[model samples]
Target: MRKKRRQRTILWCAIAAAIIIALLWTEQIALLYVLATLGLTILMLIVAFADLEGAKRSGQATDD
Candidate 1:
């Protein structure tokens, strides 16, 4: 599960970066920055929760 999660994380992050670059290449809209920021924030949240849950389930956390 953790390996799958890691793969998905990398895939989604790459996808997000591609989209941002595509948008930048096609247009110089200021909104693109906002969209990129939101995308990055979402990716960060996914990574954070994934690691936390994995650690907890594996009893790797201090409180576990």
Candidate 2:
């Protein structure tokens, strides 16, 4: 359930980031705001495909 939530959050973030980027590019938004959001978008893309379950597997001593 938690993993699914994380995936959903990432998807929503990507969509929101795209919209924000579009608005920032077309509108006269502040440069700092654009850069901050772009940084967030890059961060979202970087960790979008990470596997939380896989990380747990490597740190555990038991399969069940």
Candidate 3:
């Protein structure tokens, strides 16, 4: 589970970095920064939720 979580985290981080770079190079749109910020915030929320779910599952396994 941990190994999977680590892989997911790395994947998300790489995706976020790639999106940020792409946004920077694409155009000079005023909302580019805002779009990047929103994208990052959503990615972080997803990663955090996955971590919480993993913890809950691990805890339940130990309890049983």
Candidate 4:
């Protein structure tokens, strides 16, 4: 489970980086849209990481 979570986190980070790169490679309206999408993706990634950490903490507490 931890390995799976780590893989997913890396995947999301790569996706976010790709979005930012695409946004940088574009121009005008498309760039704006991509940037917005990238921002949302980053936000979601942060939320996911936070949730994962919280779950891990809870799991540890239960184990103890």
TM-score of each prediction: 0.51, 0.43, 0.49, 0.45
Which stretches in model 2 have alpha-carbon errors above 4 Å?
1-29
**Model 1 regions lying over 4 Å from their true place:** 36-64
Weakest lDDT window of 10 consecutive positions for candidate 3: 55-64
- After superposition on all C-alphas, the RMSD of every candidate to the true structure, in Å, is 5.7, 7.9, 6.4, 6.5
Pairs that collide in candidate 4 are none
Candidate 1 lDDT over 1-64, as tens digits, reads 9999999999999997888788889896687978868879999999877767666679854652
Q: Which wins on lDDT, candidate 2 or candidate 3?
A: 2
List model 4 lDDT by residue over 1-64, tens digit each. Answer: 9999999999999997886777677745677787788879999999877878777787784553
Q: Where is model 4 more than 4 Å wrong at Cα?
A: 28-64
Best by lDDT: 2
Q: Which one is best on TM-score?
A: 1
Decoy 1 TM-score against native: 0.51
lDDT digits (tens) for residues 21-62 of candidate 2: 887788857864877788899989879878878988898998
lDDT of 1: 0.83
**lDDT string, candidate 3, 1-64, tens digits:** 9999999999999997887677678865566768868879999999877878777787784553
TM-score of 4: 0.45
**CA lDDT of 18 in candidate 4?**
80
